[model samples]
Target: MDDSKGKFGFFADARRLRSFLRQSWRSADASMRRGAVVMWCVGLMFTIFGVVGDVLETWWSSMPFLTNLLTSLTAFFFAVPVALLVLHDVSHRMTDRAGRRAAMAVLAQSMYRLEASVSALGPVEHSRHSPTGGPPLTTGSILEAARARFGRLQDLEGGNAEDIREATETLRTAIAQWKLDRLPDQFIEEVGRVDIEIARLRDAVRPRFLQSDLEWPLDRQLHSLAEMANDLIKRPEQWTIESYNEWCDVAERFSQDFDQKSEITLLEINAVFDLLRHVQAMHIRRTTFVQALHDFNLSARTALWELSSL
Candidate 1:
């Protein structure tokens, strides 16, 4: 009877130990989940706070009167929507991990439907006759196009020198006129100087309208332009009037030598011309868009300033 009692007691203790370990594990898991939630919330809060602070600071510095109003309006209009988005994303991620596939799918479908509806309601066709019709040009777009074309030119074997000169000249001219407020004034002035140099380089490379021009001078100018371009590429930020002038001189000399040696073909020249024209068109479009944005911002800023003063 004692043996039987001892066996029963041992069994009971084993059962109790098992229960205790299971409960402890569950409690630890719950604590970890709670900690993760808290950390996520803290991170989200900080992100929203930083975004709001930045917006307010920019507004205050650029348009003080609009700062409070804009901040409040944005908090209600933009911040609320953004916060909801973040919440939705966090909830979705959590639910997904917890094996809530159906809920995740439903949320995703709802978002897609909402996006489709909004897109359908917006204007589908742009007016061809409108001066501002078609997608507005942006700095990003222009730079992308330039980089692509430059890469293509670099790939060509024994490319027509005149065409290269024309293309480079076009780019130089466009950059000279580019006015990004974010860009320093010194950069702009330097770009303009480079533009002049490119033109000079082009003139030097072209076969003399009259044969009286010395070949050595042309060669020297072409060499100078090539060297200058290489230097500029190395330190694009150091773009100055002096550097540009030197490049133009080198480019002209190189072009003149190229013109003298190569069987002057119209095809290469035409291709180069076409590229230049495209560059010019892009420049005009970008300038117009930037100008429009600048004007709108200026007017808005002025109005806000006046109202604040009153």
Candidate 2:
């Protein structure tokens, strides 16, 4: 029985290894295809150079025989249909890559927006319309509604509320110290609005907590996102493919970090704050980003299509 188990484990390991290799090969093939397209485009430029050089030599010199030989060689072997093939391959690959990247960027943007919106719902009390028959909602009523909507208050019962409040306050202090008062009016207004909301929520929840120590993990994440946004805003012209890729990387890291640290029960709390509205906003942003990319892809496709038709 021991020997049989050992054999089974060995076969399982072997199968896993084989599967890994197959995947690696497929990835390698795709990379090679992309590289090949680039190289083919470069080769076509060289072919054009060779043809032009031959033609110029023929016109400038009196050597008919040599000129004819060179022209014939370049035209037959280097110039004609090969350049068209290269152009087709390069354009096709570029379109495919652009479409893929655009999709990914949109996905990243949506997640980032969702995270921001969720962070906005930090144990806050606000006047809201009451579902049951009563007077117009008060801040206290809103808090109760939020608490009730987010079931299993056990997580929020402990130090979680304090942690959130502290982290938010720390973020606000940092932003204030950064002396961003001179920033664009719109940016200052947005930041001020968020800050006011944070302060209101903190004041509402402070009585229940013993201490308000900053949550290091959450603070770090907020700081990182703020820094990235600042950098991008400061130098929008520096936004390149690489910059966009970095944005995606940061957004993904933020998502993963938030997931690892956040309690699963928090999703319930999130539900209380009209989470669907936030998600809907994120979906709209995502759709807009995707549409922009789709338009770019269509433009690329049209160019290729015209070339192919010709």
Candidate 3:
């Protein structure tokens, strides 16, 4: 019985090997499939040759050539399984490489859309609605800008086949938070209150910031944000851990700029008080946007890297 079990082991091993080969063939691409088919056909032909050669040698015992042929035919038939395994391994490697590249490409596109949406928050001469002859909007008005930017952002084709829902939701939440934090209804009301104080103290008025001067520093801040956005879009390949850390630095700079006091040319102490508060609010929006973008970039980079493991 022990001898019989040992004798049958080779058959059991071959059966397991065949099952593995079938799974590999099923997973392989078109080129590998064709190669597999050809290998199997060759293997079958050699099997037939081995059988016939064996029969011929048995029938014609003097034919030594048939014995040699049968040996070679058996060897070739055995080689086919080995060839199929190698083909499957190569195909799997190629498929993995292609899938990684594809996932990265999708990630890049998503980053582009995200950066564009953030850039839209920067001071624009006109809103997207302006081209359509709707109400003219100012970039400084966070309410209008957020609405316009989010409108376009929400409609973007975000993420790829693998966990697209996760990617999309991450981006959407970041952008929506950016918008929600900046809706300037309260800021506008505060501005109204400050305007009343400015009216009460009309006699003590002096220019703290000329309209141009007020806009200039704010404009510089906007320019910095724009450059950051443009950099992210232009260099999607640089979305690595190092680059993400660098983005955190960039976000910090923007945040610091918000806190950094600008030289304000005072018109009236009371009037300027309200204006400064409004500017502070705008800065908060800018900082929030930058931070949100960094988060989105980080999330996306992590997601793309995880694909390598998969």
Q: Could you report the Cα RMSD, in angstroms, for every candidate shown? A: 29.8, 25.4, 23.9
Sort all candidates by TM-score, best to worst: 3, 1, 2
CA lDDT, every model vs. true structure = 0.43, 0.40, 0.44
Q: Identify the runs in model 3 with alpha carbons over 4 angstroms from their true place.
A: 1-19, 49-59, 81-85, 88-91, 94-278, 297-310
Q: Over the full model, what C-alpha lDDT does candidate 1 score relative to the true structure?
A: 0.43
lDDT of 3 by residue, 169-189 (tens): 332333333333343323223
Candidate 1: Cα lDDT at 158: 34
> What is the alpha-carbon lDDT for the whole of candidate 3?
0.44
Clashing pairs in 2: none
lDDT per residue (tens digit) for residues 152-210 in model 2 = 34355323654533333332322232222112324323334434433432343222121
**lDDT per residue as tens, model 1, 98-179:** 4333323332343344333223322211222222475654444544444454455555643565645544543443343233
